[model samples]
Target: MSNVVAAAENSYLAAFDQPGRATVEPTPRPGWRQAARDRFAELGFPTKRDEDWRFTNVGPVARTEYELAVAPAAVTLDQLEPWIYPEMARAVFVDGHFVAGLSDLDGLPDGVRVGSLAAALEGGDVTAHDHLGRYAPFDRQAFIALNTALFADGAFVAVPAKTVVERPIQLLFVAGPGERRMAFPRNLIVAGEAAQVTLVESYVGLGTESLTCPVTELAADPAAVVDHYRLQQERTDATHIALQHYHCERAANVSTHSLSFGGGLVRNDVWAVLDGEGVECTLNGLYLTRGRQHVDNHMWVEHVKPNCNSYELYKGILEEQSRAVFNGLIHVHPEAQKTDAKQTNRNLLLSSDAGVHTNPQLVIHADDVRCTHGSTVGQLDADAVFYLRSRGIGEEAAKSLLIYAFARDIVDRIRLESVRTDLEEFLFSRLPKGEIVRQAV
Candidate 1:
């Protein structure tokens, strides 16, 4: 084992021994638990040298030890309303354990199962071993391995065949204040054949200091349709690392959105696999950062079969001395014919000190595939800003309008009105208003 592995093991052992960490009483399971622990021991965390992780570094994270997240600490609705979306089925996880009292899953449709991974595993309602940790590259990420070995609570959703769930299900993972919280917030969303549903997973942190490590896996069967959204809003002193993988079968449709607004250092790793013909996939994201924060998004979309289509668009705004990175790739395998894929990444720099790196890459092995990727990093359009100012719009308002317009394309693509509205409101709150532009003019 390498020094990195040794360090991770030491951290894990220390975390397990700490009384401050929440006691994870995963329902009594002998075989599955042992298997998972073995798998974790065999695989350690990944570093920047790894090919897929070359763009991001985990050195700072590796040195620090984090306990799994715990339940919210007496926070009122007014304190959390900004993080919660209205009218959605809510599932709450605090300190890495599901909080039944705070979660509301009363009106779910028939045949749809929603609960903690531990509860589901204990109840024998779902096979924890069948799909858990099955898709992620365990060898590459030490954090992933740690999560696999230690994840005590998670969310599981099952939609029956051809069933259409009109309402969206919300999963909220909260890491309360002063907690060395580490949570493997796993989400297994299996959409049965021809089934349709929408889900939103929101990660929030209370208090000043917290940590969240989350992994989610989503699978869609043939002809199924699913929409997934990941929203991250935590305290400024918080740290977060999340990995999401999506598998789409023949003729299936999968759409995912990532919205990030908080954390000291944040990394989001996403991979989408088109495993069958006629599959359609879309990946969209928006991230805004200020202060000394760092946000990284690395994504991959693979077309493994013929006649598939995928689109990716990510936009970001960086303020103050913050930094942001976007890396997206689309791969068309040799067997994939008639594939249509497009990727674009755009960034707006709000401060001269801010740093933004955007890369959109494409690899095609098939002859008859249409694929394109491009990335651009630039400042707001001066002409547009001037036009707005000439219209009697305050300088701050002018800049705000231009910035908002710059991000409108990605926001407008959200098919769900409720989610779209929620996102818009969040964006409005974070963006600079008419004042900043006027000062500049």
Candidate 2:
């Protein structure tokens, strides 16, 4: 038998009693923080026995010792220059705490509130108080429970009824230089009835090898339109665990794009519910991994109302010895007649040792629903590569051209021009003979 050593400093339960948590002063039966802590204590870390996590093991996260990141690190605008978009109103968080000086939110419209969650809580923002932890459930999720129990700060945004936000807002979480520090960021986006908004969340840490766990909750009111994008670009030595929950009301249109480019081990858990009739929900994601990186995307979509439509598409490109997993499920309730849902997951393996595990599932309780699921895992077409090579193109450039073509469909579907351009540039940089790929595109 292999010997295992457990350290008290790394114990989550021991750290819960520490004096510097977000909810240090609290009381009541099953208070928000206490309740989450209790649940997490019961659940602990999931093992391979758990069906949802059987393919991806989180033992590294459970064993690593991390100090709670409650203070903001000194980060200058120059350091954020790479990720910052001058045209977008942005909120910056360093080591889980908001840094007002590094953010820019000028010329925001009336009835729109975007800032740090801690400030909103201290200043008594009614909307923030009413809906902070309303959507992300912590009872059954260990990461969500741990984040809720120990989270100190995050990003909060609220758009009022009938308003159109002309400027896109960005919430950037930066994990600064540290020795295995951990940060939990909780974000909430609330769009009122008939409102329209575009929002982006970015997690970027250039060289920091920290652990970041974030939970984001979004609610789209009746007839509202919400366009959301999430970008994860942490260092290759870091670990990231994230969860997002979205509620789509009657006639609301909600679209979310998840772009993951970096991190050593990453887990993305996403769930969306059609809460009312005539709702439209779309989920799209792209992930690229090299080296020994491992990435997993788990999605659960529920249709609770009739006449609602949901679409899911996720694609991954694995190189070297990298690995990836995609688990998508569409659950249709008995009353969800006329529900339409389609799920697809595709993977491209650039190396013989690269691997992928994809499971697209459908659980239907209604006979009138239309649901379909499909997955594909394969290597590049040899004849296509040969044809490109025969056309006087170098082997690497020819391969890059084909790779670019494979990913073009998803990137072209993005409506946000600036984000699309940046992602295109990013994709180009990752390809071999990337300039040839860009010119060919």
Candidate 3:
């Protein structure tokens, strides 16, 4: 093993061995924690030698000596106002600890629970313990194992059967002012049978060079409908690693959207398993990178039952010397006959120095399954730019207009008005002369 990976493993194992660390929370299954630590120690940190992490190297993260952040820094609502959505029920966490003063969960519907995971575990909420580490298996992935063993606080949401939540629930995680400090945030969301809910996970940093590792588990029971959004807007010097595991039952519908705009090094891993017949799943993502930043998105969908449907679309806008990676896989089991799956990945490069790697795979064991996958990497269409320039638009404005038009294909799918508006504003600001296109729209 390399020195960097060895150092990282030792640091985490030392922290895990600290007295009182394992008993910090009254989790029903304490053995899971010890097992996670052992798994992490066995696997160590992933490197370029690993097949899944071949394109992206995490040596910088592994080499760094980081301490766990335990205390909430001095921050106020005014500083976080820019990222807050007024229409959603917000739950705030600072430095891996839930802060009640900054959260607003008023007027929630009956039988709906939205709050902190730490509180639920301490208050003896059996539901939290029952579903916390059930879906996200940590034995194979080192980062997931580290998060499962170290995470102290995160969001916990549950929607009872047959209830429809009018407002969305937002879980906002803010990294405070600290260099070389790390925070582990874990979330568990359960949607009962026939329940409907929209949940958002947003990560923001206070201009600090920190590390944020988060894991979220989502369970959608029979006939349930879930819309999940993950937004990452951290400091350019920060490193963000996250994992999301989803399980869909019979006839359940689940859609996830990932939007990433910031972070020095970012990796997002999403896995979904359709365990019952007639399940529907959709995954959508958009990533914009500039400077020397690196972003990666890895997704896997397993069709374990027959008559299931899945769709995936991901797009990237790269500029300067930035880089991005997209890896998607679709697997159909022998029993999963008549499965329909499709995957597409598209990337647009604004600079010749920018780079992107896209891989889409389909593995089918049933002859009746229909699965297709493709990827494309290209630059802006010169003909479209020339056409716009002939119509009295400047060269820069015309290029920006064409780029924005290409991105709108995914933005138009956002159902929430506030989220769409915020995303549009943010995307426009990233272009050279995007104000012209914004005004035209």
Compared with the true structure, what per-residue lDDT tens digits does model 1 show for residues 1-441?
Answer: 586566766676555445553333334333443454555565545666676666566666667776544343555556667677768888887766777777788787898887787677667665444556557755556666566656767888888899998889888888765656566676677888999999998888875657677878888989999999888888778888888989899999999988888888898989899999999999999888899888999988999999999999999988999999888889899999999999989999989999987777888899999998888889988898898889898777887878887778988888778878777776677666734533442
What's the CA error at residue 176 for candidate 3, in Å? 1.0
Residue pairs clashing in model 2 are none
Looking at model 2, which ten-residue stretch has the lowest summed lDDT?
A: 1-10
TM-score: the better of candidates 1 and 3: 3
* Deviation from truth (RMSD, Å), model 2: 2.3
Candidate 1 Cα RMSD (Å): 3.6
lDDT of 3: 0.88
Name the lDDT of candidate 2: 0.88
Ranking by TM-score: 3, 2, 1
Q: Write the per-residue lDDT of candidate 2 for residues 1-441, one digit (tens) a residue.
A: 122323322377666777767772112223888888888877777778789999888888888878786687788999889988789999999988889999999978998999888778778787788777778889978899998888888888999999999999989999887668888988878899999999989999843568999999898999999999999888988899999999889999999999999888999999998999999999999999999999999999999999999999998999999999999999999999999999999999999999999999899999998999999999999999999899899899988988888888789879999989988999899998899887777
TM-scores vs. true structure, each candidate: 0.90, 0.96, 0.97
Report RMSD (Å) for each prediction in the order shown: 3.6, 2.3, 1.5
Can you write out model 3's per-residue Cα lDDT over 90-120, one digit (the tens) per residue?
Answer: 9999877788899999878998989889888
By lDDT, the best candidate is 3
lDDT for 109 in candidate 2 is 93
Candidate lDDT values, in order = 0.78, 0.88, 0.88
Task: Tell me the spans in candidate 1 whose CA falls farther than 4 Å from its real position.
Answer: 1-5, 13-45, 69-79, 127-129, 434-441
